[model samples]
Target: MSKIKTKFTERIGIDMPILGFSHSTDVTAALTKAGGMGVYGIAHDPPDKVQARIDAVRGQIGSRPFGIDIMMPKGMPESETLESVQAKLPQANLEFVEGIAKKYKVPEATTKTFYNTVLRSPSYFEGQLQVLLSSDVDLVAFGVGLTPDAVGRLKAVGKIVGALIGSPHHFDAYRDIGLDFIVAQGSEAGAHTGTIGTMVLVPEIVQMAGDLPVLAAGGIGHGSQIAAALAMGAQGVWLGTSWLATSEHAQGDHAIGDRLRGKLFAAGSGDTRITRGSSGKPQRQIRSAWTEEWASPDAPEPLKMPYQHALVGDLMTAIEEHEVDPLLHSPAGQGVTWSLELRSVAQVFQALSDQTIAGLDLVNSISKSP
Candidate 1:
């Protein structure tokens, strides 16, 4: 058995130092049953759908502790209706998407219902927060920073609030703002990451955070990396890309699971690039023709925030619906090269535990020999 233990596992009541982030209820339940915490990604779902997903995970986990991650940007603009945002998308970008669809032989399909779904907008932020407060979720994690008032409200309702940060400066800024824990996400991470690598970022944030527990995220797909993170003073590892190829991830005709699995299988460490074209935030994504098109010189600049996301909402829907393999892309870290095999969540957790123990043993042996 692995000897890894930290305040994070103790506080969260989990056996392992692995925290899996996924949008699938199956994956979350499997991770919980495997003795690690599973944080469901609900930032992309509306409030009503978010509650339903939470309930689904609860139905399977049965009293096990799990968390939910949401995006609550600090000092967000005033709430704007989804329609209003969609209407503001520039025609040039619209024409570009149309051109891509035509070039790819994408069928004509109305994505009106998809466009109307308001997942992560300023307008739905409060409603999403209320959903978490009223649910049985053991923890609530903010992908972006949250206001002190919002953090206090979550804590008042007996929820442990955590935040993900990319730099020590952001950590220093928000360290004393009532965050229960901080996830130091490095540049190699999937979505919305910073410029520092995990080796440098984790320890820096851990030092800056003082007693607050820091979870090392980004480029952590293997057990050796988990042991290394613990050695770097991280309480645990926050993993998302590693779970993307798991058996329990969304896999169907309409889902991007199969394509993502294929891409990870064929990808190398250098195959991903960080581009702001996806959501107007610099995020690491598997290189594909879709990303290539966005990076081309003739492509219009990606709009900011909700507008960029809104602009491509229907295009993404069409890609998913039509299974455009060339255009299919998902947020994946540099460690994606390690995720070549499709394993069950339980198997993945077991491998992490075994590898962590082996890695620690290797270090111990080397130290004794010296």
Candidate 2:
């Protein structure tokens, strides 16, 4: 029997329907080389750093296809002058953040350093997009704060515009604005995700998306899950947490990687807490001192999207620079446990695709009926 082709497979110029997520340059290039799309998250990086990362991926992958993931939640767009954004931030919030910094034993200079740099801006997506376009990105996917104008501009360039949404209702919003595809990300997805789990989210989004392809995300790592998604009518799968453990994901420091791997094996289900500790929105992160303090009643209510993330920006930098585990924040979904043993992006993508085909075959055989 011939292999089934998915709309996503054709649209993104990949042989497999996997969308590997990692901030790691190596993993992004490896996934593209291995026949699946590699999506790099650029929302958190400064413009210069983001450009360098894109350049690194291009240098590695050459003409192979890849995409960029920019997070746009309900907050500031980076387009505004950094000074303007800094002015808008409440003084009280900064004071509170500093208090926590002091309590965490974070150096005053370190706390000040975050505020001085890593300014918040979703609007900078266009600037980042412009950079990616100059490179070799095949698709540019936007999540959270996607604007109509940005969607139009991306499509005008003949680029595939994928908006990741938590609900089917938002699909209409994007469709109305002309998105090429909608990534129906369930709550199970890692990094800033919504409440609805993938099982119910994918079909709902597919139905609402009209002719646009819907890629199922959140909690999908294995072939059976991909097969289930395809059976339910999704055109492809966007796998993030699955790639965290891949050899390509050198993004995580040694401590972060150890904690992540430890979570997988010790499994009473790794601890999860919905905290406004990172990026402000109530995102799920592995339980840690920062998140725990933020969740505590004494801590001020996490600021809304931009404010929340802005408040903690310095701390994240500190964590990275110091290589501190407690300060290391990871965005993850329920499916992260399936990720173990770092392999190349190609290996992970092939495993997902091959398994999906096998799972689909098994289902079809059963359905062929006696």
Best by TM-score: 1
Error of 1 at 182 (Å): 0.6
The worst-scoring run of ten residues by lDDT in candidate 1 lies at: 250-259
Q: What is the Cα root-mean-square deviation between model 1 and the actual structure?
A: 2.1
Per-residue CA lDDT of model 1 for 56-126, tens digit only, reads 88999899999999887654456676678777778998899889888998775555433335535565788
lDDT tens per residue, model 2, 127-238: 6666755655678888667777777777777777788888767765667887777788888777777788899998888887768888889878788999999898898888
The whole-model lDDT of each prediction reads 0.82, 0.71
The local distance difference test score of model 2 is: 0.71
Q: Where is the poorest 10-residue window by lDDT in model 2?
A: 260-269
Models, CA RMSD each: 2.1, 3.5
Off by over 4 Å in 2: 1-4, 74-116, 251-270, 367-370
Q: Please state the error at residue 343 of candidate 1 in Å.
A: 1.2
Model 2, residue 242: C-alpha shift (Å): 1.3
